[model samples]
Target: MNTAEVLVESLEREGVECVFGIPGEETEALLFALRDSEVTFVPTRHEQGAAFMADVHGRLTGTAGVCLSTLGPGATNLLTGVADANLDKAPLVAITGQGGLERLHKESHQALDVVDMFEPVTKWNAQISDPDIVHESVRKAFKVAEYEKPGATHVELPEDVASEECDVRPLDRRERVRRPDPDEPSIDAVRELLADADRPICIAGNGAVRTDASAALRALASDYDLPVAATYMGKGAVSDADDHSLLTLDSGDHEEASDAIQSADLVVTVGYDIAEHDPADWNPSGETTIVHLDSDPAEVYEHYNPDVEVVADIAAAVRELNACCADLDAEFETDWYDDVRDHIVADVTPEINAGDPFTHRGVVTVLRDAMADDDVLVSDVGTHKMVIAQNFRTFEPNTCIVSNGLASMGISVPGGLAADLAVDSNVVAATGDGGFMMNAAEIETATRLDCGYTILLFRDDEYRLIADEQTDHRGEHFGTEFSNPDFQTFAESFGIEAYRPDGWDELRDDLEAAVESDEMAVVEVVLG
Candidate 1:
């Protein structure tokens, strides 16, 4: 068997169902091998779109989503989405074809040092210089990428090495990697702390939801009368409909949830990562006692010194905490949490007087009503992102994906494609005009794949998020406005059905029709 065959075999053994990328000369051998294997290769319109597809796939599935690209420009194009996956804590394996081993000593065309460029953005990375090491490298890439605090990992295979005749076999993934259990002392300390504290609250982060700690989180909250506030990426860590839920706390200053966190005597952060939401934003005083539970220790931040850390598998840690705090006789007060949650609900409540113009909130409200509990919504980075985060309440974990870590735009379309492919759930790629244009070409890719999903494009004809920021700070804005192509025409040009909803009423019907159609469709809603 050749090295490329062995590499593909390794990916299959790793349970990679599909690989996304653009075809190139350097990846010729690998492409042919993948074509012959059970692992399907999804050719995307652009390398960035391919990476975003893999990113969303990773977020949906606990396994690493794989993306491939050739050297230099191709590799560079994949950087943004790969970095987004890394910061968003999505498990992803990024494979890139590099120049031949013989040309390493000299500067070659389309051969920038791909490994060096990927170092900062990846959890681990390596170039398989030797053909024999391909299996080992591939195995390590998947393992590292899917490990706790899951992020992106890279593997580079040179063209010459890939085509080489190597007698090698893929590694066997016989056992699961289990996280260490939380120390008994730490759990004991957390129990004692929870018992002593009068006003305690839980801040659930992305890790909590992604690690399947939501059930345990709900139990902990339900049992202790603890209020659970999710970070943006951690939406639905606890059901927003639950009385214990405090939807989001990312809007720090002047937000009721922020005030709730400040007023709490003890703040229990479950699987919270400092990257998505800064402790300084919510805990300005730095005096609130923190108890963190996760697979890793809390980050050493000025405002995030944890008094007790239950470092273990998030679900296991939370379950242990629940079991530990099961018999607490302490009486805690949740009147403040009730007030904050009520305010949050009121703030996000739609201001729609029937038949009004479709604003961001209106579109989100209608879409939410149309989707099932487990259906997915991939939110692009824009002003609509703020609207969705504030107003849209996900009933289940990982149902609402927002790239808040790297927070890259242009992810929605491609991400929705992956979401559709990875799960048996209806998907909606919600994007503003600005973000939709960035990867609009991928609509064709989605069409080719027959990905039956809805594209909810909010048209404002500018970089609305940035414009809003400018408007808030200053009276005027510059370089934030732009013109949009006829969105319906653009979407239809890709051979997909497009709907330019006339008003709020039409939008609701259009969204339901698009999703129910089970065909590639775009529903354009004009936003102010």
Candidate 2:
């Protein structure tokens, strides 16, 4: 058997169903091996799109999503999406093909230090120089990528190594590794802290979503009458429909939620990561008593000092907290935050008047209402991202995907494809004009794969997000405006259905039609 075949077998053993990437000369051996394997290699128009697809796939599934790329530019192009997955805590295994070993000592075509290039953005990375070590390297990549605080990992297989014959077999898949339970002392400390506090709130972060601790988190908050606020990446940690749900806290527009967090004497941060939302914004004085509950220890920051920490499986930790708190007879006050929740609800509630031009809030409201409660919504980075983060309400964890950590543009199209592949529900990819153009070519990929999803393009013909920031920080906007092509025509040319909604009434109908169809479609909505 060839080394590439052994690698493919190992990937299959890891339960990888699909690998996304654009094939090139260096990747020829790996692609040929995959042809016979059960794992399907999804060929995308660009390596970046492939990486984005893998990123979303990992975000939706706990397993590591795989993406392949050739040497040099192919490897570099995958960097942004790989970094996004890393910062966003999505499990991803990035495989890159390298030049033959003989040429490593000198300059060669499409050859560079790929392992080193991937080092900054990956949890772990290695070059497979020996055919005998292929299985171990592949296994380790998947293992590290799927471990706690999941992120990106890399494996570079040189052309000669991939073609070399090897008498090796894939290792048996290991049983699930059990996570340690939170210490009884830590649990007791948390219980004591909550019992003495009157106004306590929970700040849910990306870790909560990744660990699938939403139900347990919601239970803890609901049982204790504690209001729950999520970061942008943690949008659906608790159902926004819940009475105690503060929606999201990243936009800084939810004044009531912000106020509640600032006034709270005890802050219970469940699976919270400082990267998703800064503690300085809420606890500037570093005085609020914090109970940090996560799989990993807290990161040191001036404003974030944990009074108590429960380092364990996130779901288990939250459940234990709820169990311990259930025994307490002390009454906790939530009237203050309950009012805050009301204000948040009112703030996001859209006003759609007849014949009015479409507003960001109005479009979001229509889309949210149109999608099933469990359907997925992928928000590309731009002004629309902020609007979606603020207005979109996801009923389930991972139902809403936003690139808040890496905050990369052009992820929505490929991300929606991954989401659709992962789930049976309808998926929506929402992007602003500037962001949509980044991976617009992926429409052809969607058509070829028969992946049905809606691409909602919010056209303002400018980099509105940066323009708005420029306006806010400076006296004027510059280098942020640009012209856009006819998106409807552009999409249709790719053999995908396209729509241009003249008004809200037309938009709702078009969106419904797109969602109900089995073919990929794009809807261009001009923002007011």
lDDT agreement with native, every candidate:
0.88, 0.89
lDDT by residue for model 2 over 235-256, one digit each (tens)?
8899998888988884336556
Q: What stretches of model 2 exceed 4 Å from their correct place? A: 250-254
Runs in model 1 lying further than 4 Å from the true structure: 250-254
> What lDDT tens digits, residue by residue, belong to model 1 across residues 47-110?
9999999999899888888999999999999999999999999999999998899997798889
